[model samples]
Target chain A: MNASITPITMPKFGLAMTEGKLAGWMVRPGATVRAGDDLADIETSKITNAYESPAAGVLRRQVAQEGEMLAVGALIGVLADADTSDADIDAFIAQFNAEFSAGAAEEADDTPPEPSVMDVKGRSLRVLDIGHGEGDPIVLIHGFGGDIGNWLFNHAALATGRRVIAFDLPGHGGSTKDVGPGSLEFFSSVVVDLLDTLGIDRAHLVAHSLGGAVALTTVKNAPSRVTSLALVAPAGLGPDINMEFIDGFITADRQKTLIPVLSYLVHDKGLIGRKMADDVLRYKRLDGAVDALRQVAAANFTDGRQTDNLRPVLETAPPTLIIWGKDDEILPSSHAANLPDAITVEILPDTGHMPQMERSEEVNTKIRAFLAH
Target chain B: MSKKSYRQAINEALRLEMRRDPRVIIMGEDVAGGQGGTSGVVDAWGGVLGVTKGLYTEFGPERVLDTPITEASYIGAAAGAAATGLRPVAELMFVDFVGCCLDQIMNQAAKFRYMFGGKARTPLVIRAMFGAGFNAAAQHSQALYPLFTHIPGLKVVIPSSPYEAKGLLIEAIRDDDPVIFLEHKVMYDDEEDVPDESYTIPFGEANLTREGDDVTIVAFGRMVKLANEAADKLERQGISCTVIDPRTTSPLDRDTILDCVADTGRLVIVDESSPRCNMAADVSALVAEEAFDALKAPIRRVIPPHTPVPFASVLEALYLPDAAKIEAAVKAVMNHKVTEAA
Candidate 1:
């Protein structure tokens, strides 16, 4: 096989997908494509997601036809040099399929790491500990009603050579649903307890949305325990927030009602797919899930506004960097404004509140650079 | 995002709900062991198989209550507590013990809302371990879901995997009506990637584990896994099958089952319970009555004999509807030649 020939296979969207249908191909068989190009629409039980091209090449034989259901990692199309012969492509396809099945057999025998539940101050917390290195450990904190899965795209990217841990706060994910007070102090304390449980004295904090407030409070209480802060579209910097999104997120139980509500969190409304809404609804249906979310909303987002203000923390906070989506609808990008002149703020355009998810590649690059320094 | 055993998944659901709502409480015999012991150590055992382990430690004694072996009194108290505002999750250690508390569940809790003309709500969940495999023998290992399915105003849930267990258990707790959540004792150690977040799989929706064109295999709970295994093995020999897991029995997903049968024109049911008047029989009747025209072959039911679940491992293996039996049933239905009625 030539080094230039690349096999474009089915991509796994979320943790739950086992197989998906090749809904359609974006480019024709002979069309030239580049890396990161939208190659095809892969439809799974959860959502219809666009499969991106992995490499730049002339689209060769479409091994798997459109509308065909294929398992994860199954070859859907082949990308090869225009000069490659038709006979060679056929031989390569056979060899690749054989090797792919062999690899799958080995994977079936391997045991992958799973997320674990941790007992922190009596609350059952879900933690995802990934990577290992000599640098100060990094902790990823999700926003309100968000779990460590929110960092799905960026977790492994930033954990290249350092230990990175992400956890779901109380009332979120597999954590205990009780959100006592749901205040910045309560959340910050939980973060501190988790860090202490992990035996980390000081670490870089990468927090998003409501987690931004918790990070601010943690630095205010025990500034020594934090090495640095990377806040992404974080709360606590301003008072104005999209209450519509908050209330809609709390009340929207079905997919139809939720898609519009979640649209406020992204620049592209199309990103609010059925699967995303279904996932959120499923969480809300859990016993006491809605009530706990109500407490958090009332405590933090009272009177149609953010309840906490940690602008002062920005003055004395350890080397902090702020990344905000220029089109953030949940928290205004203006919060990124009026910040200390020394703090480096990157307001990404054509993105929304969930820049970490919408433009994960760019967001991860900024975060990795911030952490390295 | 991680692998969690069926035991851990259920424990997480109970703990999350208990913490989220002060009204949610857990009661069962030795759910929290070490009650009134000479050592004075609290939370001695968390269920007979430790499925509820660590819950008592987190929720403490007030929320995680331990009851005596008397099933009637505790189960009645749970029903009462649920009616009076508390969302109680009472454990009936083994499903066989339901005979001791059937009145509280069937006649009282299940009928409260309807009897009161929709004024009353009983957000109660009775979780019990069912199915045979463990040496627990005949009395302790009964797949008694059909008994509860016979009752009205009651939701019957039979979770197929760790993911289903967590989601469906949470849904049962949040539901306003009485829910009978049955767990397979043999599946406690079965692990799968369950989301750390609390999620609920809606009731009455059947999950198609595998979609095929040749035959349709409808099964419930542990049998769903077996059907999937059979389908995989059959696919290798050019015979394909679709496996369905009707997550809830009462709000049974008739549409999914009928649609699959209609598509394939062949049906095979694998039920773990006794042969007489079982889920397999019920489903077979449903298809015979409703989708008869769509059928190209007679429906085949792979079930154990009406005899009690045997004690010996060999007998138990023979008595259960396994992958091999399901495969044979599918082949039989596939090979069946339809004859005109004489």
Candidate 2:
């Protein structure tokens, strides 16, 4: 309760990240830290990211050790003003641990996140709706071979202002593997229908890769329904694509083979962690995912090249911001060059195809800025 | 509807299950191949032996899963999904590939129901090609039903022929418990009258392939075919034999074994797997323990030597417990020294 005393607790990177490994402390004990300062490096199952300080204070106690894993909201370290005594911080830490443990137990006893499946037309779609607020809301459509978790890093970040919705594209995640026609139009209609099912008149469309293409198609078809567009390394704008990556991703069944193929997605190949690859493989193992992926790939990428050209659509309507990774081997960054002056394209260097995952902070900032405008 | 191979029957069983139940799913590497190929042709290789052929086309992608060769994740996912809601049928491609995903099948799926205090029902089925005659050598050609039968909560089924294949497979798919349905790779082409409509052959029921009086011949999977052959030969020699195919090993028909032993008074069990702790030894032990008084002679077991399945034709033939060896075992059991009215 003290004004100067600040609690440095565990941070949740993504919605699914309930716990994380305290890899190591960046700032040692007694170090003076300001808000947004790198306090520690936390490793989640998906990726490792630096834990930023929430308040300006002197680091009094490094309670969590390196390699120690703790649930989100569990105190790892304590921060207080330089004038605060050691006894006060110790007492605070003890109280915090007790309360955190009690809270975790209460949460455990509480009902878990209810994942509901809805029948959209004939196909079954799995959807997770979180957060609630006024305003048009935000619909998160993940890219090719992505699910709701693809927006794990960005969804909550955007949810602070409005209701955030994320779902697995057909044949991608928990959603139906029946990608009817597996085309941009097919997916865009599903997204549109999902919005209708959720009773939302209009929403900010945030999408990645193929989802971006879908978002563009949605806005093109019904521009009045989409308020804003956040396209992350979108597909339809590009001619050159890494067919090998797409092919390897769909074909590689074994862990030994898949690990290498997944590595192509990120510049820091390490980001394509074992669990992520395993998750994709698990989705691929689902009844219809392979066939759906194939149909989708064929419909979208004919001869290893994207079939849909949405540059014209993007140029027509809806505030569109194109964010691409300069080193995006999947869909080369050069595609972002000749985009119409109406569309804003930001190509970040030293990043791969998955800018949302690799450069989450930068991508989040851009999205936040675009939404704000 | 037309004349279908045993392979096609199994495929139809899967296709029918997928259609009947929305929860039922099929997954395996190359089960529906050509995912993102240059030719844009998907579902090219329905399966390694084309057992799952045209399934992807019929059911589309959602129900017929083509997994990446990552057996652990997919198989484990199948177990996890089955535990959750879906009834997943995972193909290990060949029974030999069980080496990779055995942990998922044995530790996870098999134990989920018992370990979870009967609250969990892992209605999962792992279909794998087993048995010899494919010249697939040591790795691929293994009659490993014994390994699966040893595990509790795991209902192991090795369909002897196409008739057994379709019914048993349907039963395995619909079963509440996890089942390891082993199909004889050699018998995929072997035709037998199979009903088109969905039907389940209950476990623990022994199919009397051949009935006679001189000796009781117990066999399983492909060895059932061998035992039938041996029975025919023994009959021609005036030494009649009853060949009993205990359809499932886990829910083994102990009553049938005891009843058969009581009738024949002489038992000869044939198992293609190695001699050490094989099904032959298991049935022999059962007859020795339960039907000891009914026995007129010693129980003889015809099984392969305790060694890896050989590659060479001669060595492989010797390693496998064939009809000739089974016939020899039947004769040996029939000629065993009869003790004075024990």
Among all candidates shown, the one with the greatest lDDT = 1
Prediction-by-prediction clash tally:
5, 9
**lDDT score at residue A148, model 2, on the 0-100 scale:** 80
Tens digits of per-residue lDDT for model 2 on A185-217? 989999888888888899999888889889999
Maximum-DockQ candidate? 1
Error of 2 at B224 (Å): 33
The DockQ assigned to candidate 2 is 0.02
lDDT of 1 by residue, B1-342 (tens): 578999999998888888778999999988885554687866656667887787888888888888888999999999989999999999998999999989988889999999899999999999999999887799988999998998998999999999999989988999999999999999999998777667788899777778789999999899999999999889767787989899999999898899889999999998888888889999999999999999999999999899999999999998899999999999999899878789
lDDT for position A41 in model 2: 84
lDDT of 1 by residue, A1-373 (tens): 7677898998866444567888789989989999889898887765465677889999998998876778789999999989998888898899989998988887774443457888987888888898999989999999987887788767878888999999889888778888898898999999999999999999999999999899999999989999999999999988898988889999886555788998888886766765677678767776568898999999999898999899999998899999999999999999988888879999999889998877776788898888877
CA shift of B103, model 1, Å: 7.7
Error at A98, model 2, angstroms: 2.9
RMSD of each: 7.2, 22.1
Q: Give the TM-score of candidate 2.
A: 0.56
> What DockQ, on C-alphas, does every prediction get?
0.21, 0.02
